[model samples]
Target: MDFSLSSEQREIQDLAYKFAKNEMIPVAHEYDEQGKFPTEIFKKAWELGLLNTCIPAEYGGSGFSAVDGVLICEALAYGCMGMNSSFMANDLALLPIVIGGNDAQKKKFLTPFTEEFKIASFCLTEPGNGSDAGGIKTTIKDGGDHWIINGEKMWITNAGYANLFVVYGTIDVNLKHKGISAIVVDPKSPGIEVGKKEDKMGHRASDTRGVRFNNVKVAKENMLGKPGEGWAIAMATLDHSRPLVASSALGGSQHALDLSIKYSKERNQFGVAIAKHQAVQFMIAEMGMKVACARLLVHKAAWMCDQGERNTEIASYAKAFASDSCMQITTDAVQIYGGYGYSREYPVEKLMRDAKLLQIYEGTSQIQRLVMARELLK
Candidate 1:
């Protein structure tokens, strides 16, 4: 099997790498410290056509495959995961429409992303519902020509600045997953409230906020699919998205590893460089191994998606393994720096912080294992 990237893929990878190194790395620390969204950097990425890379060509997107998108994410994430997340949020919000929406819906909702740099959010998790997506308390009531939606969504990325939202709510609480439906809502719609931005542990530069919809009105034409299709749309979107998440984690792991290696060789102890010590050598070795393995898993899952394969199991495997690996690798990177690693002045500390949210969002590592188990059993 060929493992090499095609020339076009290599070009995309190189472009992303240069943009990350030249633009993102320099300002990442400042954004994190200020807890502000990197709007300028995001605009640059949008100008580069880095956002909405996966929308079909007919919609004016480049129509890059999942594998192509993964490559871009890994490179961009290596510079700053928070910034990468801000850019990637656009894809997460648009995928459901790409997967389920009709041509007219695509023209209305998806076309804007191609013509302009507009942000969109996917609203699913609530204050009480994260892993239990089917248990969301949001309600969608039929309102003749429109739907009235009422609910609170927590941990919504891009919510603070999003122009539109892809919201999921239920027609009846008792119907569980079957009651769920997907709809698009304009962020400026009446009764919509965007709460304060979250003070997160990592990805601080990526906008995360609470959104409350109080009897919000949504036109019937905004429905993604027929009633009861929200669950399927949500699950399918996650299956496709998990690999990109894994790629982001892989990028963080690689960045941390790079820092550790450079520092180990430059810093000296016992009258010699730390890289000479077997203990330090071993740590570096393990970090390298984990990054490699995680990349392979992420790529395999993305490849499966591009090939039109149902990748629920492999997607879980990639997300779980890559995120777990990233956490460990980043931690080890900090250890390699000793006291300096613990300091906020160094890049490794930031890498460690960024590595954390990868495990929690998209799907927690524990939730991924549960998904894998169910897929295996079935």
Candidate 2:
């Protein structure tokens, strides 16, 4: 099997890499320290058409395949995951519409993305429910031509500034997953409250906040897919998104590996470069190995999506394996840097912090395993 990127894919990858190195890397530390969103960088990415790569060309998007998007994600993530998340949040919010919305719905909800650099958020996890998506406590009530939604969503990326939210709520508690429905809600609607931004351990430059929907009303046309289809839509979106998440992890791991290697070669110890040390060499070797293997799995999953295959199981595998690998690789990178790695002055510490969230979000590593096991059994 061929394992090479096409000319177009290479072009996209190179573009993203240059942008990340020149724009993101320099300011990543500053943004992390200030805990501020990198709006200027995000705008640059948008202007380059990097922000909405997956939307179809007909809808004003570049219509890049899932594999193409993964390449871009990996490149950008190598520079800064916090900044990467701010840009990737646009994809996370819109994928559901791409997967489930009708023509008219797409026109109304997605066309705006083509016109301007607007942000949207995916609202799923609540204060109490994370891994147990079916147990979400948000509730929705039918009001003839409209629906009234009431709930609180936590850990919502881009919630602080999102113009729209793809919300999930239950129509009947007893029905569990079957009762869930997905709806698009304007963040400006009455009674919608965006809480304070979260103080996170990593990805601080990406906006994360609590959103409360208090009797927010939306037209029935805003519902994505049929009633009771939210669970499937959510799962499908995650399946498609897992590869992007894995690519982000892969990028961070690669960055960590690159930093460790450069530092080892330059830092002298006992009148010789540390690269000559066997122990340091082994660490770098392992780091390189992990990054390589994770990239294969990520690209494989993305390829499956582009091929119209049932990728749920492979997506879980890629997400779980790549994220777990990144965590280990980044940690080892810190270890290789010795005491300097632990210092905030060095970039490895932030890479370690950012690598952590990869294992937790999209789907926790444990949750990914559960999903894989279920798919295997079937």
Candidate 3:
């Protein structure tokens, strides 16, 4: 029955929001306009223990829980989701290692990230693959003392600046999911090429590009679990990280609501404040409800993850509903702002554009529905 955040959670929330207000909000538009990654902001966030918060203390990390992660994500996304994506991609890239790596593997791969400001990219979706992970054409083969990888991964976030890449490939394309394996790769390895940065429609502040592995060599010890176990590892990674996506979307929705409420009260329309109009009130009310429900769903999923429970269904529910709702909420906010909302000078326009990628990534709303259906049938 208690809905309050624990004292620890509240303190985490305060620290995150303070950083967001001080650092992210002021420069979000500047970076977005230039389509540049916020390196300074990221360095500051890292200094504050905001970036890469989940690696265990033994590995020189804070070992924060899933709920703690959601709180930080929401606050950062509220400032700017584009910057938040750069942060979230680290968690996305690292989750597979935490879920499937042995002690030695974890120590070797994850420890350096904590020691300094670094970035990583998750390499799963291919040039021809988006929702269908099993349809990937990438290949990873056994070499005598090492592993060899060859593939082109598309739509990889933080690809341009990543120091490390977590790659997924198949031993035999005919075997599909059964042939899949996950391996960690050094981006500096020979035969690796990073394509030109993509000119994206939104989240322009995050570096994204295609990565081609001609014949990349990786240490044999870098593979996570056994050869056929990658499919499960990928699935588990999604289940755990989907809520983080939901939290980001939730933050965007809350931001849209806050902006709308402020504008409605200040803007005079027909000789009175727009807040006095019933039509405006209705839209505002709907926006408020969307924010409230989405927060509940987002938090529930994150809570389940921290408890080590099976949350595949709830995670999908949160990611789908929260992201879809964020798009709606941002769009409606623009509507309330009328002509001004469409212009780049105002913040809502960027939010509306940024809100879009949330639905498209981390599993589209349609894909999440299918996941829910499959789980229900089982």
Find the candidate with the highest lDDT and give its number: 1
Query: Residue 35 of candidate 1: its Cα lDDT?
Result: 90
lDDT, candidate 2, at 137: 88
Q: How does each model score on TM-score?
A: 0.99, 0.99, 0.98
| Cα lDDT tens digits for candidate 3, 1-378 | 767899999999999999988888888889999999888888888888898766878888898989899999999999899999999999899889988889998898789889889998999999999999998799998888999998899999999899889999998899999999999999999999999989987898999999999988889889999987899999999988999999999999999999999999999999999999999999999999989999998899989988899999999999999999999999999999999999989899999999999999989999999999999998
Count of backbone collisions within predicted model 2: 0
Per-residue lDDT of model 1, residues 124-167, tens digit only: 99999999999989999999999999999999999999998999
lDDT per model vs. reference? 0.93, 0.92, 0.92
Clashes of each: 0, 0, 0
Name the lDDT of candidate 1: 0.93
Span of 10 residues, lowest total lDDT, candidate 3: 51-60
Tens digit of lDDT per residue, candidate 2, span 176-220? 999999999999999899999999999999999999999999999
In model 1, which runs have C-alpha deviations exceeding 4 angstroms? none
